[model samples]
Target chain A: MRIPLGRKIVTYFLLSTAALLVFMPTLMAVVMSFMTNQDIMTGSFPSAFSLDNYRRAFEQFSLMHYVINSLFVSIIIMIGQLVLSSLAAYAFVFLEFKGRDFLFYLFIATMMVPFEASIIPNFHTIRDLGWIDQYTGLTVPFFAMAFGTFLLRQNFKQIPKELREASQIAGMGEVKFYLTVVLPVAKTSLITLGVYGFLTSWNMYLWPLLATTNDSVRTVQIGLRQLQSQEQMNDWGMIMSGAVIVIIPTLILLFLGQKKLQRGLTEGALK
Target chain B: MTEAAATLSQEDYILFEQTKRKHRYKQFIKGMLFLLPSIVLFSVFLFYPLLRTIYLSFFLTDASGAPTVFIGWDNFVTLFQSSIFQQSIKSTFLFVLYTVPLTIVVSLFLAIIANEKLRGIGFFRTIFSSGMGISVAAASVFWLYLFHPTIGFLNIILDTFRLEKISWLTDPSWALIAISVTTIWMNIGFTFLILLGGLQSMDKYLYESADVDGAGYFYKLRRITIPMLSPTLFFVVTVTIINAFQTFGQVDILTQGGPQNATNFIVYSIYREAFTNYQFGSASAQAIILFIIILIMTIIQFKLGERKVHYQ
Candidate 1:
């Protein structure tokens, strides 16, 4: 069953090429970010490295403001979704009430309806609430997520029933038990949900675009688009630098929570 | 004494029933309290918007984005008649057709290649998975650099190969293709990981048995591996179709629905109609149409999958 040398070499060659293709664009972006405008225009490797592009990206495009906006929106949405979904999941897992199963199924059904279908009405709702161009508009609608609820509910159901009974006998209130015991026991899944929520919120484009018109509330994704459109074909280095800045946080998140992110993604499919 | 004992038992039973009722009421209240936040959010954001969209689809709206006139079925009729909407439908399906199958095939191939247990395989997996780190906006910007007609990396490579420099974004024919390429590259990481997971989780004893049967790699893959991996493949296909149908970020950033509406995907079409043109009624209709299309596609996939996918 030993593989032939030729076939093995071919497999390695193909895999390496595929891997290179995947990595090359990000690598190029990083390389181009430090290059001068002239070097980028000429499509040559940089002879001299400088921070000019990053400087231009910040000053010209107001990249820092957009970064802050994106961070603010993503963090708020992450925490909000985590809190709300976990509470909802806890009820579904531990509490018994009439129509509980029905309500849970209804919540799950929301996942089937894509956000695009509801954007028009959502826009009107946000506007009517006087929330447009505000952080509330950007973050509030996304605060409760069906996917997060489902993921947490699955994990919470796996927690032992005896633990709940023991906590009850110990005179621990439901809130206290949830905060101290349930959350800690389901920490990994919660982390997974958090990472997923952050990434999705950070990468959000359409909702933010529809909800915000002013520079004051624009997220990084929309900001990058504006930068690209405004700088169209003029300063490639600056634009690539903007791109680099936009992806850095997400890349860091991926690095820090690779396992959680992987599990979260596969969780949807496997279930 | 017997009469006193009967009275005591009756009091105890009445007390037990009262406490049970009280406890049930308390549990109900507690559960509702815990669920209140999600209920409020979902009602406002998801359920209300969904029903409103359907309602808006049948009525013409004013400039302030409020439904003004009862235009029963007019929006849908106009949408069906409009050449732009038709083109959008065509372009969206084209985009899906171009992207989903190619992505599945390419990712499956990469997964197979990366499935080998070799030294430094973890590094390769990281490299292959790196695209997952890039946001759509970021990826579009990076690709915008590469897709530049003159002095871009792609054109430079084309020059080296003695090929003509193609206008990747501006040309109508190439615009969708360019966007599709960018999407495929960005999506490779996720699909690859899923397929890789599927491949790795496959039972090794099957392969060992195949080897004992004198089956070659291709034979084993075709007979054993593919059937075993069908469940994962089904999942990937379903997810990919849904994702491809909702493609917006790339089209919005790269082509803005295009040079000649060649890259006008369904979501982008809805966006342009609702926001840019202020045609809420039309947009809602289009949105509903898109929703139905996705629902039908999902149902069809599941139906087809049930027949083909071998769940172990």
Candidate 2:
């Protein structure tokens, strides 16, 4: 249906403003990151841009350690979630059992419980398990993600059951059938889950900050916030640089996986 | 030949029975095994912690800073007596009141506009979703610069329109609104993405049918789009509710719960108690109460969703 000119104009205006709302802060942040400390204090752009703030951020803070730590944790989380969720999703989809539906519902039910509620006691659980200031505490709790399982299970369900039967007729066992038949069909959702897991883990702030008290174990987001607080005055340039440092990779992944994410998020969030 | 036939038939029967037994055993093992990780993680992380929190809430810490005695309602009583706690509750609700509806409406409008079959729509979609890749803390810091009173871009724009400078984050009354505006801007991207997915996933056949019946645009939207979109709407609202209540990072970075604790959300308050003051006992109590509140709100959402949200 063709929209009226008046409605089209209004839509265009609204969309332009929406885009502005999204871009204004990012543009400002990028511009501010290039400013010097003197420029920031004087409330204007510097006569010449310099890398001094970036240098200060690196020297004063263990910025590189936090970046590497966050990367290590996120990579581990992505791999761990991909392996476990795929295996579990394969089992749920291809292997028929007496109580399959019941188990799937149980998995879905856990997704409703917010992480905030879980964190308090889960913190003590980590403490009891002697994982404080350890990467295991960061990665282990996310091994059995209900949403990832659901995403992969939905993808696996799309395959024809006859394919599994065809593999069986060729004398293939269950695990081999899953490897040959099911895994190939589930490639996209698995990739989607991997990206989602990586990005989510990369951006997480509160949980890791609360779990570890030491500087050596902080994530990038926490590192930036810590740097912001430690400075004698808020250095817009350094803080913006820190923000840019943390966000670049996630942005790349989001761009690469936008198609699959669009599908996964809609399907996952829908019924 | 006869002897071979007899042996073959007998062996086939035995083999069939053995395979059946093995399948049964494997099914049992696989069922439990598939559930094993989830059961372990949920039990250790979710259930155990929940029970521990409940236990901790009722106990008082000793002089040694360990939980020692069953204080039994003392935490709850103290919470009621504290004006700051009461204020946090009010602030939290007010924050939710400002953000939730605005976010839903703004994102929904953007989704509708972006979902149109206009040229250059993908570029517009990407621009709107750019905020999703930025961290909340980073976004708040950026907003701080944008809302700078004297030389900020916002002031420059307002001056062009002959308006006086508004101290967005500094003024007490407008501080929450300023924080809220930033929250809405940072958050609307995800909500818009979800809603756009819903809009695109919708069957085109429904619109064609409505058109055949001479349905107007608003009519189709109201009668068809809204009802079909309820499931997505419900999901977005659920996420928004959880995010709104636990909005810690933005308040921490932008306002620091400032201007007389206007933005001191319950989660931040809990953080300050536990980390800043080392009042672990009180913090745990606050966390437990916050959990109960979220649980109740979620239950109510589920109940409402069952009646209104359409799955298919």
On lDDT, the candidate that comes out on top is 1
State interface RMSD in Å for all models.
1.5, 2.2
DockQ of each: 0.72, 0.54
Query: Where does model 2 sit among the CAPRI classes?
Result: medium
- lDDT (tens digit, per residue) of candidate 2 on B56-141: 77887643235787888888889879999998888889999999999999889888889888778888888777667777767776
Per-residue lDDT tens digits of candidate 1, residues B1-312?
999999999999999999999999999999999999999999999889888999999999997778999989999999999999999999988988999999999889888888887767777877777777788999998888889889778999999999999999999999999999999998887888788888877799988988888998899889998889888888888888899999999988888998899999999999899888999999999999988887787676657757653457
Off by over 4 Å in 1: A1-8, B1-15, B298-310
Stretches of candidate 2 above 4 Å error? A1-10, A45-52, A59-62, A97-102, A232-234, B1-23, B62-66, B148-167, B209-219, B301-311
**lDDT, candidate 2, A114-161, per-residue tens:** 676556667767887888889998888877788888788888889987
Candidate 1 clashing pairs, residues 3+ apart or interchain: none
Q: List the lowest-lDDT window of 10 residues for candidate 2 chain B.
A: B60-69
Instruction: Provide the global lDDT of candidate 2 against the true structure.
Output: 0.80
Q: What would the TM-scores of all predictions be?
A: 0.95, 0.89
